[model samples]
Target: MSTVLRSIRAAYCTQAVVDWLALEIETARPTQFQWLQRTLADHFGDGKRTYIDSIDADASGATTRFLVRLNDDHCRTVDTVRAALAALDQRHTLVGPALVKLLEVSLDFYPKDDQARAYLPLLVARLQTSLEAAGGTSHRLVGPTKRAEHLDSTDTPDPRRTLYINNKLDPLAWRVYYKITDRDQTLPRDQHRARVEFTLQGVGLHQYGINTVDDLAALDFGDFGHLLHFRQFKPLPDLIANMKPELAQLVQHATRRDRNMISLYPFGLHAYRRYNTGKHAGKPRNGGHPELRKHSTHTTADAELNQLVRNRLHDLTQFFTQNWNEK
Candidate 1:
C-alpha cells in the first residue's frame, strides 16, 4: 500500500486590516483578505465559496477569520499547500512566509498493488476489530501526543459499511478511520479502493508538534508510527487454516460463538492455556500454542502491511522537505 498526503490547511496571520465588505463589492482591499480568499478559492477550492469563521472589528483594528480548505477535490500532495502559501506571499508582497500556521493535515492509505485489491476493503473491518480487541482505546506511543487517547467514539452502523473513529469536528482532535468508496459506486466497485485516512487538526497538530509549515516539513514518522497500531491484525480464518492441527483445535474451541472470529492469536492463546491446565489436564500439557512459530500470518500479513504504511509516512516527510515553487 502507498499513502497520499490527501489534505492540508495552513493559515497566514497578518496585522494588515482591510475592508472586507468594500472588497466584496469590488472596492477596496485588492491585495488583502478578499484577494487571498478569491485566489485560494479558485485555485484549491474548486471555485466554491470559502467560509469565514469570524470577523472582529474593534478599536484595535478589524480582522477576518476563515478557512481556505484543501481536501480530496485538489491534488493530493504537500506541495499543493506549499504552492498556495507561496503564491499568497508573493501576491501580497508579504515579508515573511504566508499560510505558515498548520491547522490540519490528512494522509490517506490505499492499495498500491493490483494484487491487494481484494484486501483493501477489508481494512475497515480489520481496524475496527483491532480497536475493539485492544480495549476500545488507542494512544500515541511517542511524540507530544504520546499517551493521548485517539479512539473516543466510533460510528459503526448496522450492516457495517464504514468505521469512523473519534469522528467529530470539535476540540481539534485526531480522527482516523476507513472510507469504503464514493457514494456513486457500490461495493466490489472499480479498483475496490479503500482508504484509511488520518486527520489531525489544531490541538492534534500541536500534539504532534506541527504548529507551522516548517514544523510539518521537519516531521519524523518514527515519532508517530504507533498511531497505525491497527495493522497488527490479520484475517482469522487464514490464521487458523495455517496453524497445526493441535493448535488449531485449541483456537476453534476458544471462541465461544464463532471459531472464525477475526482475532485468534492472543485471544486464542489465553483460552488454549486455560484448557490445557484445567479440563484437559489429563493430556500431556502442550507448550505455547505454536502460533508465534508455525503461523506466519503475524510476520507476513501484519508486519508487511505495517511496514508499507510506515514507508508511506516517510515518503510524505521527504515530500514536505522538498522545495515547492509551483502549484
Candidate 2:
C-alpha cells in the first residue's frame, strides 16, 4: 500500500463497518455449521457414523443443517455464546489464508517498492466481471438513492460461491468458502445425500433399529419409497466402487492432523493472525514497513507456489493412476 492510498483507506475503513458488513453477508450464506461440516468434509477428513441433518435450501441455494455435536450437554451455556461472538468479531476482520498466501507470493514477482494496493480496486472490478460471467452478482448496495437511509435496508446478497470466485471476497473480513447451490436438483456443497440425511422420519425409524444402509431393508418402504427417491443410485454405485480407494487415501492423508489440507507445511497461520488483527494494512509488499517486522517473513517465490499447485494436480493424477493399476 502506498503512503497516499494507505492514508485514504485508513481514513475510511473502520473495524466496526467491516464487521457489520461481514455479519450481514456471512449470515446470508448457509450457516457456519454448514460451512464447517461441508468444508471439513471436502478439505479435511470424514469419519463414520457422521451424518448431516435435514437440509432446507435457502435463497442462495445454500442449505441449512442441524449441526450434530455429540456431546451437546457440555456445549451449552454462557461460555459458548461468548466464544461464538468473539470468533465472529475476529472472523469479520480476516482475509482467507489461501488469499494471503497468494499476495505474499506475488510480492516477490512484482517490483520491490510497488504499491500493489493501487491495482486492487481494478482487480476487484475485474473480479465482479468474472463473477457476473459465472452467473453471480457483485453485491451492490446501489439504488436510486441520494440518501444513506435508503441504502440501509438494501440487502447484502447471500454469498453463493467460494470467496476466491465471488466478487464479494471482503478483503476486510475472513474468507469463508461458500457452498453454492445454483438450483434445485443440485447437490449441496455440504455432503448431505438424500439417503443419509437425518430427518424427522429418519429419527423415528432409528428407534426401530433402522440406521445404517444394512438396516435399510428391514422396512419395505412400499408406499413411502418417495422418501428415498432422491438417492440417485444408478451411476453412484459404480462411481463409489471405482473411487473408494482414492477417497480412502485422501481421508487418511487429511486425518493425519496435519496442514496437508492446504498441502502446505510449516503454515503461517499463527503469523497470519496479525493481518486479521489489522496490525498491517496488507502483508508487507516486500516484507513491508518497519511496523510489519513482527509479522513473519512472508513470501513464496512464484515458482514454489506454482510447484505447490502442480503438486496437488499431480497428487490427483497419481491417485487415479495408482488405484487403476491396482485394479
Candidate 3:
C-alpha cells in the first residue's frame, strides 16, 4: 500500500473534541465530539464563546475539560470568559438529556460529516428556541460586561496556538505536535532542534533457558553463523529469542548506531534453507519425506536436528554482534 500523508494544525480550545476524534479513529469507534464541533463551527461561524476547561460531575464521576484558544479580536475580558463558561455549565446540566439524545441520533447517522451538518444548525437553533420557550432567559451571562473590554481588534487568532480545556493530560498533544513540527511550508528552513528525556527498562535472556552471560559469550563463533546459513529458515522468531541478552546490553550501553548487519540473519537463513535436501524433496529418505512431514514414532534419533538448532543459535549471535556494534 502507498503511504498517505496528512497535515494537521493545532486547534486551540477544541482540545477535547480533537482528542475524542483521535481516540475514536484509533480504536475504530464512533464519537460525538466531532459532530458537535462541526455543528457549532458551521452555525456559529467561529463566534467568540466560552466553554468549560474543566468540569467535575458528581453523579457520573466524569471530568470534562476544554482546550481552546481565543481569537485576538474576539478576546473577551477574563471575567466575561469565566461567566460564559459558568453559563455553559448550567446549560449542560439543564440540557444533559437532550445532548445525549442528539449524540445517539448522530451516532446512527453514517457519513457523519455530511449528514450531521445538515441537522446540526436545526438542532442548535431548536435547542436555543426550546430553552427560551421554557422561560429561560437568553442572557449574556459570560464574557466581559462591556464589549469595549475586547483584548484585540484582530478578528482571527493564531490557529497554531492550541487552547486546551485541561491544564495537563493532553490526549491530543501528540497529534498537534506532529502537525506543527513536521508540516511543510514554503519558507526557507532554518536548523532548529530540541531535546527530550525518557527512561526505559531492560530484560535478561535467562527466561529462555539461556542462563549466565557465558552461554551467550560461548556462541560468538560458528554456532551463530549456522543459524543464518539455512536456506528457508524463518529467522525472526528465533533471532529475537537468541539475541535478547545482546539487545539488553545494547540498551544498557546506549549506543547510537544504525547497524545493517542484522539483516543478514533473516536473509542468510532464508537463502540456505531454500535448497535443503530434507523438506524440499518429496522422498522419506533423510527423515520423513524430507519435509519431516510427520514424526515417525519408530524412527531413530538424528544428529542433524541438534546441529540445525545449534547453527541457528550461532547465526542469531552473529546478527546481534554485527548490527549491535555498528556505528
Candidate 4:
C-alpha cells in the first residue's frame, strides 16, 4: 500500500488559536478525518483506517502537529499531502474564523526511510524564503464602485463561448489495432501522433448565468487549454457522476454559471475592463505612462485568466454570503 506522512508546526499567539483550529477541523464539511479516509481509499485499496503519528500542542507557546501514514498509493505521498493542505487552506477561507492565522506550513515526502529526516532542513529553508518574500499588497483595486456599473461601462456583461475540440483519432485507432495484434508480435516502435486543435466560436444565445450543459458549452476555450478540452470532450458529466453527491452538485452549479458567462464573451471582457479600470483611475484606451502602457499591454493577456478566476471567486463569495452567515 502507498502512504503519505506530514508534519505541521504552527506558531500562534495563544493556545486558543490551536484549540479553535482543531475544533474547526472536526466540524469542517468533508471533515479532516473524512478527507484523510477518502484520500487514502481513492489511492490505496479500500482501507478505512488511518494512523495519526502525533498531535502535540503547547499551551504556553505555539502548537506543533504531525500526521503520518495517510495511505494513498497512486502518487507521491508528499505531493498529495501538500495538495490536501492547500485544500484545507481554501476551506478555511470559506468557513474559518477571521482570527485564525496560518503563519506557515511545510511539507516533505519520503518514498524511502533514508530520505525523510534529511529533507527537514531544506523544508525549513524554503519556509524561511517564503516568509521573507511575504509583504504588502501586490496591487490595489480602483475604478467603478458598483458591480453593475463596472460591468456596463467595461462593455463586458458576458462573453461569448469559444469551443476547443480535440479529436484523438490516433490513440483510438492504435488501441483498436493493438487489440487485434498477437501477444508474441512486437509493438510498433513509432505510433501515430494524436491531433489536438482548439476551436473558438461564439455561443448561439445570451445567458446571465451558467447552469446547464448548453450554457457550459458557451465558454471560450481558445485561451485556456484545459477549458477548451472540457468544452469539446464534455468530461464534466462523467466527473460529476464520480464525485460525492454534495461535491457533484456544487460542481454542476458552478460549471453552469461559468459556461453562461462564457456565452457572453464581449460582456465578460467588459466586466474585466470594468474591474481593472474601476479599481484604478485611468482611461480605457489610454491611462498609464507610455512605458507603463507597453508593460501593461504585455501583461493584459495573463490578466484575462486572472480576471476570469476572480469573477468566479466573487460569485462563490456571494453564494456563501447568501447561504451561510459570515462570522
Instruction: Extract clashing residue pairs from model 1.
Output: none
Please give each candidate's TM-score: 0.52, 0.17, 0.15, 0.17
Q: By lDDT, who's the top model here?
A: 1
Quick one: best TM-score, which candidate? Answer: 1
Model 4 spans with C-alpha error above 4 angstroms? 1-297, 301-303, 319-327
Each model's lDDT comes to: 0.40, 0.26, 0.23, 0.26
- Each model's RMSD to truth, in Å? 13.0, 27.2, 27.9, 25.2
Per-residue lDDT of model 1, residues 223-271, tens digit only: 5555544433344466577789998778667654663243322221111
lDDT of 4 by residue, 1-327 (tens): 001112212210000000001111221332334444454454445444544322343443222333334322221222333344444445432233211111111111112333433333332222211111111111111212322222232232211111111222211100000111122354342311111111112221122232222332233321232221111112456656666899888877876777532222221111112224343445546552212221111111223223333343343333322333423
lDDT for model 3: 0.23
Q: Which of candidates 1 and 3 is the stronger one according to TM-score?
A: 1
Worst 10 residues of 2 by lDDT: 98-107
After TM-score superposition, what is the CA distance of residue 60 in candidate 3 from its true location, in Å?
14
Look at candidate 3 and tell me the lDDT of residue 185.
38
Q: For model 2, how does the per-residue alpha-carbon lDDT over 146-212 read when each residue is reduced to its tens digit?
A: 3221111122222222222113232211121221222234544232110101122223444445443
Q: How far off is model 1, as Cα RMSD?
A: 13.0
**Model 1 segments beyond 4 Å from truth?**
1-35, 42-52, 55-62, 72-79, 89-119, 131-159, 167-192, 231-251, 254-259, 264-301, 323-327
- Give the range where candidate 3 is weakest over 10 consecutive residues by summed lDDT: 100-109
